[model samples]
Target: MPSVHFAPIFQRHLPVQSLEPQGRDLSECLYALFQTYPSLKHYLLDDQNRIRQHVAVFINNQALKSRTNWNIPLNDNDQIYIMQALSGG
Candidate 1:
C-alpha cells in the first residue's frame, strides 16, 4: 500500500490527518483517507471532487500536473505528499 500524507495547513479548516496508508491510486486512496477523516473531504477537494487551488500534491517528488483531475499511478511503498501552496504579493 502507498502512503499519502496531508499537511496540517488545513487542520483548522478541517480536523483530518497527516499521514495515512492509502492503498493505491490517487482517487481511491484519497477517498478512503477522507472516509476515515470526513472533515477533509470539503477542504482538500471541492464540491465537484476536484483538488483545491491552494493545494499542491506530489507523487514520488513529481508535481501533479493533472490539476483538477490527476492521472498518476501508484504502487506499493510509494509516497504521496500534499502541501498548501504559498503565495506572496
Candidate 2:
C-alpha cells in the first residue's frame, strides 16, 4: 500500500490526515480515496476529471509532472501528498 497524505489546508475538511491505500498507481489510489471520501473528489478534480488548478500532487516528495496522466506507478512504501497550491505576491 502507498501512504497518502493531505496537506493541513485539505486536512481541515477531511476525516483523516493520512491513509494507506491499496493501489498500483496514482489514479487507482485517488479512486480508492474518492470511494472512501466522496466529497474529496470535488476538491481535487474538476468537472472534466482533471486535477484542479489550485491543487498540487506529489509522489515521494517530487511534484507530479503530468497533470493529464495520473497513472504514475506507486510502490508499497511510496508517499503521496495532495496539497492546495499557494499563490499570491
Candidate 3:
C-alpha cells in the first residue's frame, strides 16, 4: 500500500500522521484519505473534484503535473506528499 502524508500546516487542522491506503492511482488514493478525513476533501480539491490551486501534491519528491486528473501510477512502497504551494513574485 502507498503512504500519504500531509504537511505540517495542514496538520494543524487535523491529525499529523502518515496514512497507508490501497489504490492504483493518485485520485483513488486521495479519495481513500477523504473517506477518513472528510474535511480534507474540501481543502485539497475543488467542487470539480480537481486539486485546489493553492495545494501541491508530490510523488516521491516530484511534483505532480496534472492537477485535475490525478491518474498518476502508484507503487506499494511509494510515498505521496500533500502540501500548500508557496508562491511569490
Q: Which candidate has the top score in TM-score?
A: 2
By descending lDDT, how would the candidates be arranged? 2, 3, 1
Q: Which candidate is the best by lDDT?
A: 2
Clashes of 1: 0
Whole-model alpha-carbon lDDT for candidate 3: 0.88
TM-score of each: 0.80, 0.93, 0.91
lDDT tens per residue, model 2, 1-89: 89999988877468788999879999999999899888899889999899988999999989998777999999999999999998999
Count of backbone clashes, every candidate in sequence: 0, 0, 0
Q: Which whole-number lDDT from 0 to 100 does residue 22 have in model 3?
A: 75
Model 3 regions lying over 4 Å from their true place? none
> What is the Cα-based lDDT of residue 84 in candidate 1?
91
How high is the CA lDDT of each candidate model?
0.76, 0.90, 0.88
Candidate 2 C-alpha RMSD relative to the actual structure:
1.1
Number of the candidate with higher TM-score, 2 or 3: 2
